[model samples]
Target: METAQRQQQATPGAFTAFARFVLCGGGVGLASSFAVAALASWIPWALANAVITVASTLLATELHARFTFGAGGRATWRQHAQSAGSAAIAYAVTCMAMFVLQQLVAAPGAVLEQVVYLSASALTGVARFAVLRLVVFARTRSQATAHAPRPVPATVARAPRPVPAPVARATAPATPAALCPAA
Candidate 1:
């Protein structure tokens, strides 16, 4: 049964997992966009992007780490790093998508164009979030086992003097071989 369960997990459920993760990233992205716009109102786009990226990164990393994956056993500094890296990749992907959208929209430096492009990029990168969650964010099978609470050490489990076996003690006197010598 354990072997079967392990084998079952080896197969990836890409679509379902991606759908869930994408939704999670989408929600985060919406929030981040608002934050960027508010900040960008005062700052230049590039600078605003950097600040917003870093700040939003701080916010998104934790939430995405928790929300994107069902099995969240390993929420550590390393996991946060991985989340940030994946998010940066998603950020880059969104940037590229926005650039393409901007050209297609033909609205040069229009605030509406900026908003539209950013929104669309974020919308498309939903797939990226799912991909990251399944491939990069999900906990390893080994990690799951490793995190399980371990049994106490042998020294703790055992007293210095062990209790005698009651069954063996009861049977010993009744056995003929125990009391009589062999001829």
Candidate 2:
């Protein structure tokens, strides 16, 4: 069963996984970019980005586990933690890109900010996809064996052996000839 599942997972090539990753992670990221911009109006841009990053990472991880990487189930807590580590790196890249953009233009337009943020996200997202496929959600040998159903041993049915009948004996001592027929 585990082999079947592994084959099913392996059947999706890297390109297929990447396409699904883009569809799931990219969708969350695009929405997060707009969310960060909206939240920035009320809060500090860095804080807004951080908030959006955390929320988007959680959502994207679940989507990747279910659809992108064919993890076969919901994201595990360990997978979530590993994913968050990669997301933090992505968050840093985006923040740095925005900071650089701000340094270059005194008042950059929303469109320009989105372009920079999204470009940074795209670069990091590619790396994130690799990490997720290779490390975070990859099923280890031990894990696969642990979850696989154990094979039941086959049992053979046998007929009962016949028992010999017992003969009645006298209370007197037995002769040698009776004890030994060839005496």
Candidate 3:
């Protein structure tokens, strides 16, 4: 019964976390797309994308740790490295999408480019959310157990050994009635 109640409570928390993930991570991704587009005018498009990807990944990891995953504090170096691994995958996905778009249309308009880039980002964002939740920000089993009360096994939880009744004074005879009181 208690386990069911806890699972029910967790369902809403997971949903809330996903919603925040979209808001925070998606917002950073959206801004990065525009930033990439602008920077591409000054540098090669691939170079611009690489620069923006690194910056946005750092920002998004911090936001996800602080808010989306309820990680309770700033992201650790290990978490950042794990996050960067997933972000690298997302970057590859976006780059491939853009490369494909370029191959398909010689002169793709800015709107078409944005649409393709955003679509690719949204897809990778879902995957990144899973990776972040399950890997980068997940609480270790030891950490979880440290905070939670451990349940005793049924055998270990058996009623405490029945305490022996007090013996009568040596001078007085001990009666059965005195030694074992009626329930």
Q: How many residue pairs clash in each candidate?
A: 0, 0, 0
Candidate 1 overall Cα lDDT vs. reference? 0.60
Better of 1 and 2 by TM-score: 2
Residue-wise C-alpha lDDT for candidate 3, range 1-183, written one tens digit per residue: 554344333332668889999999989989999999999999998899999999999999998877787665688999899999998998899899999999999999999999999999999999988888877877632244355556666775568888999977766547878777889
Question: How far is each candidate from the true structure, as Cα RMSD in Å?
Answer: 12.1, 6.3, 10.3
lDDT of each: 0.60, 0.87, 0.83
- lDDT tens string, model 1, 1-183? 454354335423567656655576556666667776677679865566667666766665565555545444335677667666766676676567666766777755646645764666566566556555655555553455555456676765555797777664444576778698788
Candidate 1 least-lDDT 10 residues: 3-12
- Please report the TM-score between candidate 3 and the true structure: 0.75
In terms of TM-score, the best-performing candidate is: 3
Candidate 2 lDDT by residue in tens digits, 37-112: 9999999999999999999999999998878877667889999999999999999999999999999999999999
Candidate 3 stretches with Cα past 4 Å from truth are 1-12, 140-145, 151-183
